[model samples]
Target chain A: MLLFFLRVINYKKNNYYYNKIEGTIIFLSNFAPMIEDKNTPKTSLSELGEFGLIEHLTKNFEINQKSTVRGIGDDAAVLDFRDEKCIVTTDLLVEGVHFDLAYMPLKHLGYKAVMVNLSDVYAMNATASQITISIAVSNRFPLEAIEELYEGIYAAAKLYNIDVVGGDTTSSTKGLLISVTAIGHANEHVIVYRDGAKENDLLVVSGDLGAAYLGLQVLNRENEVFKVNPNAQPDLGPYSYLVERQLKPEARKDIKELLAELEVLPTSMIDISDGLSSEVMHLCTQSNVGVNLYEEKIPIDPVVISTCEEFNLNSTTVALNGGEDYELLFTIKQEDFPKIKANPNLTVIGHMLDKKSGMALVTRANERIQLKAQGWNPIKE
Target chain B: MLLFFLRVINYKKNNYYYNKIEGTIIFLSNFAPMIEDKNTPKTSLSELGEFGLIEHLTKNFEINQKSTVRGIGDDAAVLDFRDEKCIVTTDLLVEGVHFDLAYMPLKHLGYKAVMVNLSDVYAMNATASQITISIAVSNRFPLEAIEELYEGIYAAAKLYNIDVVGGDTTSSTKGLLISVTAIGHANEHVIVYRDGAKENDLLVVSGDLGAAYLGLQVLNRENEVFKVNPNAQPDLGPYSYLVERQLKPEARKDIKELLAELEVLPTSMIDISDGLSSEVMHLCTQSNVGVNLYEEKIPIDPVVISTCEEFNLNSTTVALNGGEDYELLFTIKQEDFPKIKANPNLTVIGHMLDKKSGMALVTRANERIQLKAQGWNPIKE
Candidate 1:
């Protein structure tokens, strides 16, 4: 019976024909097979009750954030964000809708989920200090799977100078769903809002765009190829930059520090999540301003350009409408432009206009086009 | 075509045949049918973009919390929870596993979702001030359905004096899932924890128990009957109290203020989400004490006892094993008992013992039984 159990566990791991039974796997845009590395042993989540599961998963997480009065192992996390203004953001990532586990590893998914919430925190120019993660998983997942997920969360928590304060664990009926809430703080004077931009503020963005979205496209393409030919191991060396951006996005935790060092504060800020156009419009609309977004000045990674060309796609459009680039987009005073002009990480993509001027995208051909919030809408898709 | 759409939607609302297609619906324990009232007009979620949906749903929410600097329509909600200690708790509720919409109204589900998080906040003897709700729903739901959900959430927030701070709206591949993060604040001196109980402290609980669990059973039973006979309108008159306890459970928000009025500080506090025995065990284990829970002293609603008899189940067993009773359980110094003795809402269940004695239930027949934490485990079930 012990030998039989071993064989069954091992067989469960390497079930090549698991796709037939994984019909419920929900990936956005396509149906992807649920696949995982099959070398490890499995422990059903049933072995541990909810409290025990939370305790086990969170035992390794060290509570180092000074603002965190108490971390896990309590009914609620206690935080002391004295004097500074507190900011909160939350997002729910349903399996298949917000994430596709077929291509996204459990660990990466965990890390990315944290990154997603932290991005919003940083968008407020706040120092992210604490986060609470709650997840619901079906019994199909083993204890090891959740452990891996928490490991990623711990990794993010450690690197980001944040504490995992509190969370909940429960069973889902279908697949895995993760909800992450990030809490951050900023001195009232330094905090930026999307409604602060004045006319003629310099529109700037950190890092690059289009890479994360293209990375997803590459992953999906590779996934499809593997679906058709399971033996194929396509080279991913060239698309590493894009794939990394998609699978393991790092929220711009350093941007606030960088701006502080330069003695420049943003007039208005928003994160580039639902594509550049969508976020840009939100910023300008809220600021009671418009923007002239220069197509030629929009930052795009070299790999994104080459990958777009290879896929017969437009890099400009990808940069405009492809979301999931966890980069900060903000407007600085024109006087501060000189301070950030030489910075390699910053790009002046556009300048703000008066609200009556209406938002527009300045094409490379010098044609003006109105901004549309046609970002990725899961419902529409 | 318009008529066809209406027919489809109206049929969808009262979907008798919908059960066959809803095999993926994941309710905890037994399978429950997907049922809904049929009079409302349906608007596809696809009609509104994600941001638009959030804006529309939150349009009516008034930002009444003084700490709220900025509510929705931003990357994050800004607050000013200064000198007071801030508390945060979160929970993820998945469709089917955590709820069955067949008997649970969308509005009630939304209200209960908020209450679940608030219960944890109040457990700390804090004032729940803000909440961020993130939900992922499939296209199978209409915009009106989501609106109904938000209405319930709005009602809860209004009554609880909480500001709907920030959240994310996204599409799910399967059924609906909601994640709520509640933020509360308290003076450091007044905040209660789960590790402060003394050996001689009096163990107490607010309100009654077992009704919520019995309510679920009643709903599931009625669901089965409705499945067998589409026209069987369940006359829930007798089970009204149980049904209300199950469906629209009010978190013990008043208990904290009431305790203050009574001038009794609970040494250790925990909310009873699970059964009485399970929570009692948790309180004891965390506090490093043992408990002598008098079975007869355990508060049970008269209706709950009658319903248990009707279902041919032991009331004590149900009170010990049945979960989802959102009552406040705490321990206070023996000197505080007289202050709370005459309170109708509060009941002294038992007393704490030394850790060496272990936890036990003293039955009416004078038999001592070790407390078993056999509360609901969705994964195991």
Candidate 2:
């Protein structure tokens, strides 16, 4: 079934076989161009070489985080996070398995790649300060294509106040791949882990769920429509929110600061990358607790409900199983609930339970369905 | 021309295409097996799932570093270096681009991958502490195959006394790729950078050069021989050192301590990753100092010299242009020369000169030849 989406678009004798797996791509390349526009000049990557490519691409990056003692030019990046405990996390994005470049713009892809890793750092409740981006690209990618990718990466670093410490850039055999490692720091007492939730802790989530997944749905449908007719320009006004969520997922860097201002330290925390249910299961399994998640309490955007109806997808299921939201999911103490209750950015979704009670979602009609982690493990399928 | 090395082995109706790019692959998978070994049981990776595969692979990886506050099973790994500064380095090894499984073993590839990154950390004059490994594998890799790869990773971690802190595992469309992020720490005063060398400093290098490159040549030659004659068991006793250097190169972790013991701090340092010439040019460019490298002073193992003679290649050229030596090259004040003069492990190959003097290789015959960086950039070729 996955093979059905693999389409090849040959341009200038360059064959790009788009392998669309269930992945939100970070394609920061400008490979996609307007048809019949031969004015888009292309320079071969061979002209720049590896070192020249690295220097040219990274010359514009500025170090904002003081923790980064040295970046780029050295064999390794030197970081001084002071006395604060350091948090490190990494994620790899493969072209065929994690992205569909047919519809996904390369610039958004680069921004999303950095955004995904920062989300993990914020999930640790630490202040993300530095990142290393290593990418493997095929020779088909010109120097200009990589420049577009780096532009997005530089923009993300500048806006998020993170430093691009160091990275490796090499050629891949067939396709493009990106590996990003994010480093953050925080005081020992303020740090949070997934294994700390108490039985009665209230489950809280920032922002709505399922929009990113819906955005992917919209993108796939549009891409299909385009493949059928190149000139077709379907209005995407209604699906803009979902499409934006899918393409340019901003990490919840503010959620950590917002929680601090509210004076509510979550007992445990995780990022909503692989849908709500999967993240909830991770917290419960790691914390040795159960949760009573209210399906109605799931904070989803109005557009998500309306779009889900249009696509014949159950909105609750989408929230529970639609991955790549990039929102923070955590459990706060009941007393701290009063502090976060009136916040528009926060939503109280459920309450933690004893291990034996198990994880279940309470339906609007009061029906109880056992929760299961439906993480999109494409390798398994 | 690269297409000449690509070969496919069809077994069990599965097509295993070997893309032999000029890279040392960290395969760490038992994908290549002894012919007619049908008894070798194989379990599909899908059976383990993403989380299960991670848990199973890392179950044996015991955290050895004190800096690792938390390893695996979290959103991010927590590390505390206390007053010491943190050093981070990352490298991505892609199959086809980096290594040819036709000759490289999975275990050695895994160890070599970690070794390659650790070399960068040691070049910074820091203590290698922790590492995060992120890998993407195709469905072709079975559970047992990846287990072999991890065994090598675990072997390297255990031997080097580093912690396997965190990582992400996902599927790739084809082949296997491993990205290793090494984190280390050192006191502020002791940390070194590549831009600190001054004119009149003595240029030095640890161990010999060109052996790793010769090792690859031997392997590639042997692989071609094997393709023609499967039953032939050619003797490799003479090239053991070269083969070992290529397959299991060790990072110079003890150099920093040794230098400290001798009270000889390097003015600037870099690792021999892109050959001696490229690295020297970088030091000169960054530190604003030129170097007069003596050709006769180059320390080459007898095996490398013999192999170079057999291959009709110039030993000096190989030492200068052949890379992946994993040796640390640095410069020290002229006053520190006496301290290291008696040490057999360290070799003084040249002297730093003023920027106007320019980078040159003073040949054994007394001819001064201008030096140029001949980094093996496969992308350009």
TM-score of 2: 0.92
| C-alpha DockQ of every model | 0.63, 0.67
Ten-residue region with minimum lDDT total, candidate 2 chain B: B11-20
| lDDT value for model 1 | 0.83
Output the lDDT of residue B50, model 1: 83
For candidate 2 chain A, the 10 contiguous residues with the lowest summed lDDT are A10-19
What candidate 1 gets wrong by more than 4 Å, as runs, is: A1-39, B1-39
| Model 2, backbone clash pairs (residues 3+ apart or across chains), number | 12
For model 2, the local distance difference test gives 0.84
What's chain A's TM-score in each predicted model?
0.90, 0.91
lDDT of 1 by residue, A147-205 (tens): 87887798889888888988888888788888899999999999999999999999999
